[model samples]
Target: MARFLPAIGLWGGLALVLVAVNLLIVEKQRVLDDGRTVLLALRPVDPRSLIQGDYMELRYHEALVPADAAADTASPETDGRVVVALDADGVATFRRFDDGGPLAADEQRLRYKRRAPSGLQPDPENSELFIGAESFLFQEGHAEAYEEARYGILKVAPDGSSVLAGLADSGRRPIRP
Candidate 1:
């Protein structure tokens, strides 16, 4: 009986792990396939050597929260969510830091994890917010092509959980391998 118990534990553990991994993969695919698409500008990146072999590292402009009206009064909590509203051009802009408040019809809530506080309080020139999917490593050796990318294509879920799917050029076309 004891010998049987050990085998059962081992198999059970492996089964649980596999189930968790499968669920995560399924959720990610769902986001990529059905989530809302938003285009975010890329903060200027040095193109000199952005490409390494095949994949390129990506950074997005939307990841930084601008010190707009709502940002100024919000508390500096790294583990909270933020509501964003799209500008006329479909660019996501910070509407307010999450405060458990009501949102405007156009606003979408995005979960945020603040990096070390910038110390620079919310102001016109220099505040930033750290949203997830800040960096992406794509296939390598395509540096020159991706260097011209100015936007990051993000698939944002209804709850504001977002992922950087790929990079895009000024024309908003996906920069594929």
Candidate 2:
């Protein structure tokens, strides 16, 4: 029975790890599938954490949420929503206002609340759009090959929710984040 119990525990742990991996893969795919393209102007975050290595902080030009929209939908504390639109140059543009109307039928919304409570305080300095994706801050310098080749793609839904989607491949063509 003791031997059997160890084997069972090992199998259970293995199964849990597999499940976690699968979930991450699913999420990556889902973000890629649902995300749209928006040009996030690089603010270039300074390199900090001597132990962590070098990386840049990113600040987007198009970060904001209109007061009207903020009132209607629950805002995430870590991040805020911006209306993503296509610019004349065929690149994406974002506005804090909901001028784009609604997120497409197929589009999905991602909120940025690490814990419960749902609402986040909007940073007046950065405007209404707070940090929607905490993943970005951590992602700096972790993978230069991945970062250099990849571009920032944002996936947004009808209610003004959003997620940061990384470019799938080098072409910088939008695939998923």
Worst 10 residues of 1 by lDDT: 47-56
lDDT of 2 by residue, 52-161 (tens): 55443444333332345444434433443344445542244443433335664333333432232334444332324443553354444455444553345566544545
Best by lDDT: 1
Off by over 4 Å in 2: 62-82, 89-110, 113-129, 132-177
Task: List TM-score per model, in order.
Answer: 0.77, 0.49
lDDT of 1 by residue, 140-161 (tens): 5566777778877788898778
Candidate 2 at 14: error in angstroms?
Answer: 2.4
Which residue pairs does candidate 1 place in steric collision?
Answer: 53-140, 53-141, 54-139, 54-140, 54-141, 55-138, 55-139, 55-140, 65-129
Clashes of 1: 9
Worst 10 residues of 2 by lDDT: 108-117
- Report the C-alpha displacement of residue 122, candidate 1, in angstroms: 15
